[model samples]
Target: MGFLGSVCRCSGALLAIPIAVIVAVMVETPTVTKLEGGPTFEAPADEVPQDATEASKEGPAAPRMGSGSMFDRIAFVYDSTNKWMSLGLDQHWRSTLVKDCLQLQPEDKVLDLATGTADVSILVGQQLRTLGAATDSVLGVDPSSEMLRRGVAKVESSGLDHVVRLVKGDAQDLTSVQGIDAAGTVADPSAGAATGSIDKISMSFGIRNVPDRPKALAEMRRVMRKKDSSRVCILELSLPSGETFLSKVARGFITHVVPLIGWVATMGSGGDEYDYLERSILRFPKPMEFAAELGRAGLPVETITSFAYGAVNLYMAKPEFIGASRTLAALQSLVRQRSVELLTLAMLREKVGKRVDAADVDFSAFGCLHFWIEDRGFGSEVNNLVSAAIACEEFGLHCVVEDEVWNSGRLHTYLQAEPLILRRCPDEGTSRHRPLEVRRDRRVATPGWFAVCKHAKGVSFAKKSKFMRRVWRYTTETRKRIDRLNEELRLPPKYIALQVRRGDKVAGNRKESVQITGMDFAREAQKHLSSSCSVVVVCTDDLTAAEEVGRALRSLGSPAEVRWRSRAEVPANLRNGHWQASYNSLTAKQRIEMTHEFLADVEVLRCAEVCLCTFSSNVGRLVALLRDQRTVSLDITEWTND
Candidate 1:
């Protein structure tokens, strides 16, 4: 009665169907089309039907894993064999794949590769249809035409005839498939790769069969959509690779016992040839190795759900950030070309701490503008980072960072590129890659200080916008944090943002803190705020200053609804990881917490209708970079940030 129950029943019925004939019947539910300008989709001889003499002439491809004719032999019995070998747990593994892919949108299309009799294909359709996702044609590609032929019938019988379609193709190179486009959109079957592509991919129990595993993975990366949630769910049969007792037993079952079960299932129907199944399973890479392979292909696995004591693994992956390859290739080329000796913190600690002179370092592999973010005020650090990144672009030098210094060495963070932290000891056997030591003037900001370290002729701003738009784009975590901050502040459709600075700012020069700074912010807000703009959000380090601003706004006879965040509201159960610089009286934990608080506050400031603050402070100057002319510095009569 339930939809999933209906799917299981349909799968059961299809599994029981026998391949009594290769018919001339045209199935209305499924469509089959051949890929043009590529290899023949037919399987090698040893695996094809006896009647197919032409394909048999091609001889059997030595790699049994990729042998389509082999799968064709077992096509009708494949699902049943899986049920027996997996102890009826094959469905559970696919259900996990479905669960991971539930983030799909209504308009997104899913590709099912190695769709034997369309089990995973139909199941995905059933699940997606339940969610009202478009299942009009969930395309399934396979290497063996026989496997696809049977799979087409299964799709029709499952009541997903309107949803699933099967075609013969190679996963190693989808480009070989006819009518499929390479431009990342699913197009008409008549077009080649120029037309379009699929959004998500699900390949169940077939990755092991692909002889060129990395190539197949790279093909997956090339065709699928690159949205943040666009994923590839690959269910692979694997050997149990653990030291646990249960793992050992599962390992034994796969190696010593599964082959016998498979042979017995064949009932002497080419039983000796079926030994290839055991070989394929044994030759399959371990879970970790496969995950690394996935990484190398630019599809980083997000989760690996293991089943049957690790006999199977469900890999869910997301595309690596776009242009990451280009960024790195560009950096690698530059580093090698310029002979810049890039050094990491470990190398630094080994040689010198805090600061090192360039004259003391040896010349080597690459020349890079080592981007640095110091433990200064949060505003100052980001300004330094952005400034240096742009500077790297301006000079056409390799733009990279030291590993320990990137995002302050926090894991689980995100970046546009792989961050390209160039670490080369070249030959610890002969070369110690000491850092490009700069005589840093501690008071100055980075890449500026870094520029001086490089002894640059000067700096330019031409590359600033380009670097910010493409290279220095914010991570999803950052966007999430900003959104959270906006929601908590309850930002209005129209409201001016006011910031009051105290602490070090008050002691710096003629600057004021506490109530005076708040008064300055409030007065500036009045200049930008008409009666029509009657809402103002105040951000401040000292609550006492915020209190002053609210009072000043009211005393100015402005009808603005004043809102400000308390120190207690700053930290949320958001990002699990963050980089904090140790300073003042705060403990390490408190320091990190405060960093989170500061980040949230600045994001709220960035979202303001108009900003009012002193440009003399780094926070005020940062507002100009984020929102440009929409900000005003109360200390300066003119609008200039200088």
Candidate 2:
């Protein structure tokens, strides 16, 4: 079931040669850089006592090549080995697609069309389960029994039998009659036999193998549930397009190196067989055109995201009419108008903590919760944390900083803000800065003898660099003063935390760079957010960051609400909340967790509003999720700025 034999299952060697040669000539040569080294060399290049001139000799390593189609045949040779190789670049592609393409569910059923050993199906199944899907959610379908056998074996070996199921049948012919048992089969023999609508339908790599392309697509449409809530997904290899210099380089690599690797790996099988691998790639349709085919087949494409520099792409095509929205357009409109912001499961513990109802707290009269660290020299991290809290408050959350014992000069660092809550004055003057005190550090007191500041200030104590010694020292003192003030004021249970990743310029193994990467707002907001009343809504690009804040709040026995940019949407019951927004606004972790919520929110809407923007991470997920929710966009340009 490896690359050597994956393509062999498609056609015999004799018939595969002619196509291979023609494909080879048309196939471009892969460029390889040649390097030369002398025979044996003395230590010094300039002058070695005019004595030694032996040179060392070496050449560039030979290029290894393989084809996209080699993957299909290699399954026949050594499936396990080929599976890992094909997945080298494919793992990333799958992760991106799962996060971007479909609206997931915990228990929803998924049918993987053209399963081809059910690799794609299994991959999808694994992701779904990780996102909290029920184990029985994914099913695999393939035309080849040999391919199906490998999938079955994999499932049994992994003990994932309940999560993934494989059925042998042609993708083009999916009817009950088409499932001929070679003698005793009872499934879809008519091929394309309708199997009703499923939550998700995925066809990866296998689509190109089908002889009747249009028929296979049509069968996909026929079997798909007519509801506006289902997903029809397609992931496959594609050729590069023009207008860029790198385009030629990429083309060269694919045509030459790919086939070369195939020859080396599948040599005994047949060079021509591997040659067909090159032809298939050359002949595959452009992504846009392929998407058009899907539209024609009745599963119009909703999202098409390319990966690996366009070597592969994932297409999410939903049925024309999902649920009540008889047309794809109708579904988009419905989801936009009827999306939810937050879905919360408010909890209480056995401990007897005082209950604060959100309804009873008059924010206007109460003003705001004043939380400030005690110091003149401020901590950058502490200030950032408070800033985040302020931002959350703008969205209607609450926070408080308890401060009493103010250490002069340093207090200003912790108190600086938009409102300038605290003022500066001479220590001996009648106008004391505090509730203030005096500090001997003139470096901090130069501005004023005593200065008022917030009980909570930003600080970056986590930095390990030697340059931040002064800041770290101030942060430590500020925290100590805060503890003293909290005890003096007898403040209620509170949560104080910091976000340390604001300076990360790039993500691990990703292309985009994150800005405004702080979880402080969510952390501080949780302190005052009543465990029984107000919900602490955490919106951050990092879900783990938000969760950490939420966990901290939870430990204090407070109600914390966390949202991610990757989350699908609020469940149907929770859609009425005003917080409903796209996942792009939150962290990746939030988006993932929210996907579970969206999958569970299956309400059919009358009409939905549409917001289209350039396909950004969160925005893309939003569009995909809303489409699943049954909204149709008349045009995608209206609400999106980009």
Candidate 3:
């Protein structure tokens, strides 16, 4: 099914989001307080661990740290208190969060959502600078105006004004973070970083403060770049999930003594908010529960790590590049829904035709294997070839494309990809004239989806791209022809492109493929377009829709001469998603010529600033793999829980 109908699926799941870390100004060291039968901790004289017995009587419904006023009172000593409370480990935790969890790249644009006193923001800026990031890459957001006030002063004092920016915004909602979009640079800082703009998000010591944690989690996932290396790293204070002696001791210390440390560090000026820290830890969901919560929020946890006797946890979630592929939350829903059929296969893995498992094979019995070749679009044919490649590799079986497939029956004759491994069942060859018993081997007909599901692991984007390029390799003449077309169209060296997939619908009573309609690929493309986007190329079946995209791009009049190939045209029958069907009825020479034209279009689609296309189309998916596994899939998953 195409994603045009999936709008509700995504919108129902997403609520516009939060990353919030509140920071406190550091203070001088204070003397440690002596506890009975234990090491001394520098805590308030008026409070002790014994007082925590009453805290147990306190309900788990601790007040959520929504606004920053409560933290504003403790902001003065937040840093120093954390250092002392964690026995000088808090600094290391933050550093690890930045260096390890974030894994910041030189080009990454970061959002430290709950930046208090701008500690994380400052760290991110420094790391980004070290990486030689030329862009003003870090945006610090927090709701506490007072905390932001101090953070601004720190950011300026640290001489990172060109790198880090602090804005007043809530972790549960980012729209309030001034104007911070992709173009809303330091010069125009009011625009909040737009959705799919941020590469990394860091929330250090902020999750406890968020009442609507799922909302914040979903928001972070929303704002993050929908590509590989995108991450949301949250370092939260957690309770020990063990009953060991050290675990018990650490638990008691964190629950009872940490609050008093806040009180002592701030000299009772901190008010009762320090006690909320203990309550936040208590009210925090258990580690597994929180992990589940994250999955449900659409930020599927890729890594969960515990530090310091499980008192602190770093929860790392990364959004998949594709349409929320096999997320833990989605799998769990399936498990719950189909517990009885847990052993049953998904309907998508339908048996296309015959099956061939090599392990059980005695291939010596037959000389040639039967492969079900069909008349389908070039995308579909390539998909089956990919499937066959994987199946052969996994089964240790040699494949031969013998039959007339891809409609014209001699489809393989037109294709230039002479795979070293796959043998051609040639029409003129002696092998073609062999006896029936000498030719007939085992049959192999693995479905396209089945192959995808089975051979998913270890096939990285790089590997997949290399494989597809090999399968669709161009000849010298083909390259020359494409270049000639590109020059005639006056396409730029590097510019944005759109792949508007009208989906696969065949002619007559032939069971039609998925139909795609009423999509907004241009909307997604517009988000990434700018004055720097000098040229845009639209690759689509429907030139009518391409006309809309061309108008939209040209409407943003710029000094950088915008150019688009608007005179592009395709026959109505071909444009209606039946190119393969029409080609089958054509002569062999016409089929070859049509193949060349299609390849040129694919080559253009293969290279773009961004491939704004639907995941519903096979060609669009193929384009995604080639675009370094990055593109606006335009899947409507954001509107639904899927």
Instruction: Specify the highest-TM-score model's number.
Output: 1
Give the residue spans of candidate 1 off by over 4 A: 1-65, 135-137, 178-196, 332-335, 338-642
Kindly give the number of clashing pairs for every candidate. 17, 119, 29
The positional error of residue 494 in candidate 3, measured at the CA in angstroms, is 83
lDDT of each: 0.56, 0.42, 0.58
Q: Could you tell me the lDDT of residue 188 within candidate 1?
A: 49
> Scored by Cα lDDT, where does model 1 land?
0.56
Tens-digit lDDT string for candidate 2 (1-642): 676585775566756654453344334232211111101111112211111100111112211111223344565654443433343555555555555566667756787876666666767777776777766677676655555666677766666677876776656566632332222234643433347746777777667656556666767766777566788767787776522334544466567766666666676564565565566666666665565556545565655565544566687776664321243234445554222100000111110011111112222332333343342212222332344243224434233333333222223343333232222212211222122111112111100111111111221213211111222232344434434422322222232212212112133212132322223344445444454425333323344555665566566655554332233233333232212223223454543344333222211111112221122232322233334222222223222211
Best by lDDT, which number? 3
Query: If the candidates were sorted by their lDDT against the true structure, best first, what order would they fall in?
Result: 3, 1, 2
**Per-model TM-score on C-alpha atoms:** 0.43, 0.38, 0.42
Of 1 and 3, which scores higher on lDDT? 3
Between candidates 1 and 2, the one scoring higher on TM-score is 1
Q: Could you give candidate 3's per-residue lDDT for residues 1-642 as a string of tens digits?
A: 458557766664443210010111122111111101111111222222222221233435533336377777887787788788887778777888999889999999999977888889999999999899865799898766667777877877888888997776777667645523222232232557678989999998887776666567767877888777888888887787444445566788778888889888989887488887887788776554465456545565655567765777887777644442343235656565343122222321222211211113333333333343445566655654554554454554444553433343443443455652344433222344221111110111112223333443335555555666666656567777666656655666566677665533422322233333323544466667676665667766556656666565456542233333332334345554344445566766665555565666677777776666656556666766666524776653221100
Better of 1 and 3 by TM-score: 1
